[model samples]
Target chain A: MGKLFAVVVTIITVVSTAIFIAHTWWLPPDISAHGHAIDRQLSETMISSGVLFVLSQLALALFAWRFGDREDGRRVKPFPGGATPMVVFAAVLVGAEILTLTLVGAKVWAGVFQTPPDPNSLQIDVQAEQFAFYFRYPGPDGRFGATHPELINEASENFFGLDPARDTSARDDIVVPTLTIPLNRPIALTLRAKDVNHAFYVPELRIQQDFVPGLTIPLHFTATQTGRYEIVCTQLCGLGHYNMRAYIEVLPQAQFDQWLKDKAAQQ
Target chain B: MRVRDLMLVGGVGLGGTAMMIGRAATPPGATISGKVTFTGTPPKMKPIDMAKEPFCARLHAAAPVLTENVTTGPGDALRWVLVYVSAGDQGSAPATETVRLDQKGCQYIPHVLVVQPNQPLDIYNDDSTSHNIHPLAKVNAEWNKSQPIGAPPIHAKWESPEFIPVKCNVHPWMHGWHLVLTTSHYAVTGEDGAFRLQGLPPGKYTITAWQEQFGTQSQDVTVTGSETKSVSFVFKATPY
Candidate 1:
């Protein structure tokens, strides 16, 4: 029975580890400029933790197999240095691993979040509602209009509650459901929530940010590739949260300019 | 045994004849027709923006769609108002036929739809983009479901009568109402702001008018014979 248990544990550990090693189910390819560092940090943590997991499981199995049953009725014996030393050593080793990973990961995290966005980066405003996301781009005026919550009326398509009638900047503001950005250019998004808490997650871009109702959060990223990716909401906001998603279109500089001009014309 | 069989057959025939006679004695019912109009200033309708939906944008490029919250017609006529027998109603029967709501051009075909309790409501998505239909129901169970392009129509029904505000989360401007009334006699005013409630028995009925923006108004109407009673409702509207 002990031998069977050891064998079962060994098989389970190997199979699970093999799945991760083979990358059968992994993240999508990174498409942002700062994504490589994040990927590296993630792999480092995964590899270190995986090795520890395998080693601990194997040691457990070995101990169980060797001391399965004392048919001779021998009393239990402590380790050479007592259990305290072993416990301390294991705790230190695990703690060191965690501390090292944190130290290394903090740099990457700071680069993406803590550091301010480039001054030349294109600024966009994002509003997250019950189950939809609306993106606003400052039009030719290059200024965002003030929003009035009282004037917000979804039926009239005044999503941001911009008083276009009075505010000239609001009149030129372009609001749409799709987020389009120029490739290889820094883009900063100020996220706000209309109702409850919501999250913006783009796996390819390696960017995830939360939107609080009373606060505006800023997220910055630069897409290295010119492709369309899905932006999904990770927060459990409401019943329609599962279907809350939008598209991010990264276009070339000239194409993006043309797209903006066309959008502005419609507005 | 033979005599008993003959009596059973005779009894069945007599019962059928009596049932037919009883049904024939009932009146053919009167109709309540009226026009819904507003007196004061109403809010101006704003054009909807469908640029996010390219298909809808191109569809309505020629004539843009307007908001339907307080849709007003010529001569202070109010459209999309639900008029029904609220009180003193004779009776209500279970709805058997299905009601359909369409999502086309990123807009609900009928701004307001009427359905009876337990009536099957079929919602169809005719647009290319997927739409999440969220019905905010207070009395009945609120549900949210998405219908992708080319997907099957969603078949749903409400257990209780409630005024549900239905909206498509994908398109913020897409708003509609689902009025689940217990009374069978109800009509939604058309573009001309005219409504006709037919097959109403001769009795005192409390007719109620419900608008999504404006609250509600009720009036007691009495029908004496099988005749058409002309009634009118004037709602005091505000710009705000």
Candidate 2:
């Protein structure tokens, strides 16, 4: 039974290690500027953890095979240098790894979140409602309109509840269901939730932020590729959460401007 | 045997008379009919592009559906305007018939639907794709659910009086309204922009005509027994 146990343990260890090395399930390609830093940090963590895991699993298998029950009545042997060596080794290895991860991970996080947005970054207002997302652009005035919750009527496409009759600034506020931005240009989004909790998650962008009720969260990213990607809601807001997605179109500067103009005309 | 037969006949007659009397206790109600007209030029509705869902796009390949935000017909008559008794005595019990709202071709069949509080509402997804029905109810509990193709209809009810906005998250342009009221005497204007609120008891009541884009216009209407009250509502439209 002991021999069988050792063999099973060895097989499991080898299989798991092989799977990890093969990278069967890996992240999607990074398409954001700051995503490269995040990717680096993730790879570093995975490598360190993978090495530790393989070494520990192999050590466990060797110990189990050598220390199995022996009917010869052989005296038990303690590990070399006793428990103190093991404790010291674990403390040093884990402490160093944790310190390195913390330092590198904090920098990556700060780069994506804490750093101020570019001075000329395009600003867009995003409102996450029950099951859809509506983006608002300030139009030619470069000023956002005030949102009136009572005036929100979705049938007329007033998803943001901007009262053009009362607020002149709201007259030019352009709202669309899809998000369009220029590639290689920094874009900052002010995320607000009209009803419940929601999240903005873009796998390629390597950025995910929660939309807390009554609170506005800011997120900024620069897309490296010019293509259409989906921005899905990761948080389970309701039954419609699965369908809550919007297309993010990253276009060139000229095309993005033209698209904005067309949308503004529709408004 | 003759006496028993006579007694049975008398009992049946008494029961019939009591039922008639119960119905007669309430006077025959009055009706309010009117047309909803627009004064200015309504905004042009843009055609929806259902290209995201090939199933819906193919369904509407011949003729694309336009936005129903402001569906105006001939003579400037507004369509889909909900006219209901806003304030008056509570009428009879809610209709037992279930109100059905269908999602077909990625659009809400009835752009605007009226239901009484606690009335049964069944939402069905008749398209080949899935739809996420979300009713944003402020006074009542707000909920959302997804209905896949061929899935059983969703049975839901609203407990409070509110103008709930219904939307399909899968199709962002798909929007509808569910107006929940206490009175069942309501009518939605058709292509002729005419509505009739029948069986309204003789009393002073507030008649409200609500258009999705033009907001709401209400007037005080007094109905005397079995009289047809004529009320017309004119909404000022904007291009935007």
Candidate 3:
């Protein structure tokens, strides 16, 4: 019986260590901004988690192997001291991790969301609908028209449901489905939802912002990559929501300038 | 006893089927050709906000107003619309490719194209607001995803077959067609309402022609590399 217990304990230790070492196969999909923070915290946290997991397994194994099944008349003695220090140590470790994570997390989120748009930042107005995104440029005027909320309709196909007939300011508006922005520039996006809540998420750029009507929420991001990436709607709005998409053209600085000039002339 | 047997069989069956599907599916390229025309009445030329819709309003020398409404009365002017064909192969039977559907000026440009099975079909938002690519497909994966400016592009494909209706939820005036075909031979109507599907395998086949408001028609045809087969699909819809 003693031999049997020892063998089981060895197996448990081996399996635990194997899992800790070979975790890449089952690494969770990294889709959040917090994933970036992990680059700094990963090696430290992983080493700690791995060491603790192994040590606990080994301790449990050693205890089981030592005191498991004994035929000899050997009695165990109770500890004069209780396991208080171990508990306190664990609490301190967890508390420290939480505090550090919170501090670092607050900073990362603030960098993307908390700051207001810089005056020179390029701004685009986005309206989310059932399964698509329509982008608006302020034209040369650089101002969004005063739109009525009740005019928002997806069924009558009144997406953005703006009553152009009533809202005279909307007459000069240019509505396009794709968004083209210059590279290496800070862009402030103003999000609005026509019918329901929608989220704008670009994976490569690590940006995700929600669109809510009746409120013009602004989100800012700078694109580090220049390739054409996809702009997908991350909100569940309706039946045809699975294939909603928009093109994001990141032009060179010169081409971008030409585009702005062309746009201005057309306006 | 029945439940236990079903569980054992279902797991193995699904696994085997999935593997076979993966083997059978192969991706072959498809052709996307269609015409842009004023369907009912062509709207007039107006200067549109260039900052908002940059790529869509391509007419530099022409008028700039990106009118969402179709021309109410008829004259031959380039219309705005997007048309593409895609197929849904639930199992892996062929190659995987994708096509783009751009929604600009409240119309679907290029009105028709073809897609392969299990390809990542991208739906684009070019207008300055919102639109939806509502594909009414059953033989394929039927779902809806939205796109806001700077949002991730919606990547979808088919695992089955069906005539899909693509609509913009935000722009009630915006509508288009997504044709998901198993075969590669298909065409879209041009300004003169003509489409030709070339390079068909040497065999007798049933060909179909469809229009959004005009309805659909099918005909029997034979094709070979040496033969130039002529086919016409007409939609007889009286003035509504």
Candidate 4:
């Protein structure tokens, strides 16, 4: 029975390690410039963890097979170097791994979040509501209008509650359901929420941020490719959260300008 | 003399039959009909842009559709106003007919729909694109599902009386309302802003009219048997 148990444990360890190395259910390809660093950090962590897992499982299997029940009444033997060596070994190894991960993780986070956006980056405002997201761009006036909650009527399409009649600056504000930006350019988004807590997650971009009501959070990213990706809400705000998704269209500079022009005309 | 007596008997029998038919034709109930009007200028409805969905945009390329938030018809008659018995002692029963709401042109066919508690609601997506139907109900269980193009319609029923806001997650501009009530006596105003609630028992009841933007207005009314009562509601509009 003990021999069989050792064999089963060995098989389990081998299969799991093989699956981890195969990378079958891995993340999609990183499409952002800063995404490479995040990928590297993830790979390093996985490798270290994978090695630890394999060593521990194999040691357990070896001990079970070597120290099985003996009918010869042999005295039991304690591990070499007693408990102190094993304790010290675990502390040193785990402590070093934790230290390395923390330092690397902090750098990666600071690079993506703490670094200021470029001066010439295009600024866009994002409003997360019950079950949808609306993106607003500063029109030719290069200004955002003040929002009034009372005037926010979805039926009349005054989604942002910009009172054009009273607020002159709001007249040129362009609001659209989708986010479009020029590729290879730094894009900064000011995220705000209307009613409840929500999250903005773009898997390909390796960016995620939360939108808290009454507070505006800023996120900056640059897309290296010109393609369309889905922006899904990760927060469970309401019943419509699952369906709350929008598309991000990254276009060339000239094409993005034309798209803005078309949207402006509609506004 | 015998012929004259026989004719008299036949005439008497015919008169009794006619009286019985007349009584059966008119049930022992009252009716309430009214016009929901608004004073002051209503906010202009902006054109809806379905550019996110190319198919929906192309469907309305020839003629654009306006928002239905505060739709006003001729003579300031408010459309899509729900008028029903807010407070009354009428026994309720689930409607036998299934209420159907269609998603066409990326917009709800009826901007406002009213249903009784536990009434079956059949929602269909008649457009070529997909739609996610989400009903945000606080008192009742909230549910949402995606219906792809040519997919089967969703069959749902609400067990509680609450006002639910329905929206298509895929299409942000698509919004609607579902009023679940316990009373079976209800009416929704058309373009003419006219509604009629018939077969109401004779009693003192409260009639309420609810507009999506202007809120609700209610009044107490007394109904007598076999009578038609006329009522009118005027909502003050704001041009924000």
Per lDDT, the best of the predicted structures is: 1
Candidate 4 or 1, higher lDDT: 1
Provide DockQ values for all models, in the order shown: 0.24, 0.22, 0.08, 0.26
Once fitted onto the true fold, the runs of candidate 3 whose alpha carbons sit more than 4 angstroms away are A1-92, A153-158, A162-169, A235-241, A260-267, B1-68, B72-240
All candidates in order of DockQ, best leading: 4, 1, 2, 3
- Kindly report which residue stretches of model 1 are placed more than 4 angstroms away from their true locations once superposed: A64-70, A73-77, B1-107, B114-165, B168-171, B178-240
lDDT of 3 by residue, A55-157 (tens): 7767777776788676676766544454686678778987896687678666766765686766888878788765678777766556666666676633223
- Pairs in clash, predicted candidate 1: none
- The candidate maximizing DockQ is 4
Task: Tell me the tens digit of each residue's lDDT in model 4 across B90-184.
Answer: 77555655666778888876677777778788888888988988888999999879898899989988899998888776677888998898887
Each model's Cα RMSD: 10.9, 10.0, 16.9, 11.4
Q: Could you tally the backbone clashes for each prediction?
A: 0, 0, 73, 0
Better of 1 and 2 by DockQ: 1
Q: Per-residue lDDT for B122 in model 3?
A: 68
Residue B83's C-alpha lDDT in candidate 4? 87
Residues B59-102, candidate 3: write the lDDT tens digits.
33265433332322133423222222222212224535446555
Per-prediction TM-score, please?
0.67, 0.76, 0.47, 0.67
Question: lDDT score of model 1?
Answer: 0.82
